[model samples]
Target: MFPRTLLLLLSLILFKTTHAQLHLDYYRNSCPDVESIVRSAVQEKFQQTFVTAPATLRLFFHDCLVRGCDASVLLASRNNRAEKDNPENLSLAGDGFDTVIKAKAAVDNVQECRNKVSCADILVMATRDVIALTGGPSYAVELGRLDGRVSTKASVRHQIPHPDFKLEKLEAMFATHGLTLVDLIALSGAHTIGFSHCSRFSKRLYNFKSKTRIDPTLNPAYARELRGMCPEEVDSRIAISMDQTTPQTFDNVYYKNLERGRGLFTSDQTLFTHKRSRDIVRLFAFNSTAFEIAFVDAITKLGRIGVKTGNQGEIRGDCTIVN
Candidate 1:
């Protein structure tokens, strides 16, 4: 018998899985090699550049956060503004967009699967590949998501949380998408493999608030190191690893850094200070497997947010524009 709380959590996940049209073998008959095809495409790009894995992973998070995992983030609007044009999303690496486009083309080349698979599904698989390739736990990605037809600049600004969000605001944002406090902490572990522009977190390095010149929670030495790398508004565009320990790997060291006031973003550091989420942050810092398990669970749930299904969206021949 399960504990009452455990049973309730299981029920919620079961309910979400059923309604989201998520399943393992959704493309078994239609496109049996879909996952492999995407894996190859992502791998090819990754070999050429180290950024591919992080870029692809970030693309998935941005896509899911704004409009579910519908690949709307890949849309290219002819007009002046679109989701990709939003200042929040403007930093999305072009290599990530190119990787998805290349993967979609690979899928289309298969005679049995030509124009049959959704770009949304390909993005999910590519994200899984990114995790697997970067020494992280691999999990089966659910399929059957339809391609969303809509993408707008307004949604990106309204939906995505910035790096500076406080714990309470972060919690509310995640809650709106059916995620919990634990999920927020786990998903943040994705930072282990990515880089952030100094502009995103420079306030913590200098002039944080009236209380202190810099964020008091940040380690003084570490803040000095970041200052040398970023140097005020002059070099704000320079990128720095989120995980100073192992920049290329996806691991729990990000949480460990938070324990020592080395978290790069205000949002990252607050997980350690806020009473409600502090314990959760410590748990992941001490146990890598626990963090990986929670992350897989959180990402699985995240992929289902606001998904388009049934006859709601189309499978575009080219992922950049809706058919």
Candidate 2:
């Protein structure tokens, strides 16, 4: 048997080999203008609708969390058995899919770049562009992820965090993807610009626990405001901004809202209520620069999850259907 030290070294080498395949310039030779191409397409889409920003950003997170950023979330099975068909994913905005599809078309339009970039990479670039478009910090995105061939709805089960999740459940789910506590908190800040369906959080305002009809952590005024917007009998599809204060901008206001019991979801509020993460929440709430920096770093790491590189997957000509 190999010595313990040698075994440890070999494992480290293997880990690096797998992850090293992705980098800032992965398409430097194959698709030299890939980033700018995706950015332009995303910008055009953003101009058409503000939903492009939050939709695309949420798409990236859901795609990565479910299947390691493989763009499997983009695959559509005619039988309605694909990942996108999953109930948890059903709410993913059509705008997000459109953003990636538009960007993919733009990338392939350039003769030399045709089919040279992966749908996964286009999704990544578009996500970064949207964040920047919504007044969030912009950062370089590592590329080289390939589209996976498999996309079963069964794969999405238990992969997503529910709106009612507490800190423990949230941490456990994120940990499966190798995200740390700080990373989880930083990434959760993405809620700054998105909207959530009323059904997702109405329970917190109505029948939270046995002791109280409403969640005690929720600010009474905010609860009243939410009730006015989302009556118990209201349509489940009604949407509310995740960040009430600065709903259109991607910033540290998410943390601030949590501080004031204004978070729209139990999972969102848990970050500030849980002792382990509260200080980080306060730190971000008080410092936009620090929040921006942490957000960029955390999202960059998030983009690296379960990526298919080298010979593992394909660069599809069409994003929605496996080529």
Backbone clashes, each candidate? 0, 0
lDDT string, candidate 2, 1-323, tens digits: 22442343344335432257688888898889889988999999999999999999999999999989999999999899999999999999999999999999999999999988999989989999999998988887888888998999999999989998999999999998887777789899999999999999989988777476889989999999999999999798999999888899989999989999998999999998998788878878887876776677678778889889767899999999887
Judged by TM-score, which candidate is best? 1
lDDT (CA) for every model shown?
A: 0.87, 0.88
TM-score, cand. 2? 0.93
Model 1, which residues run further than 4 Å from truth?
1-20
- The C-alpha stretches of model 2 lying farther than 4 A from their native spots are 1-18
Over 1-323, each residue of candidate 1 has an lDDT whose tens digit, in order, gives: 22443453455456545444778888999999999999999999999988998898999999999988899999988894778888988889988998899999999999999988999999989899989999999998888889999999888876887888999999999999999888899999999999999889988877678565788989988988988898886767788999999999989999999999999998999999898777778878877877887788899889888778878898989999988
- TM-score for all models, in order of appearance: 0.94, 0.93
Angstrom error of the Cα, residue 190, model 1: value is 0.3
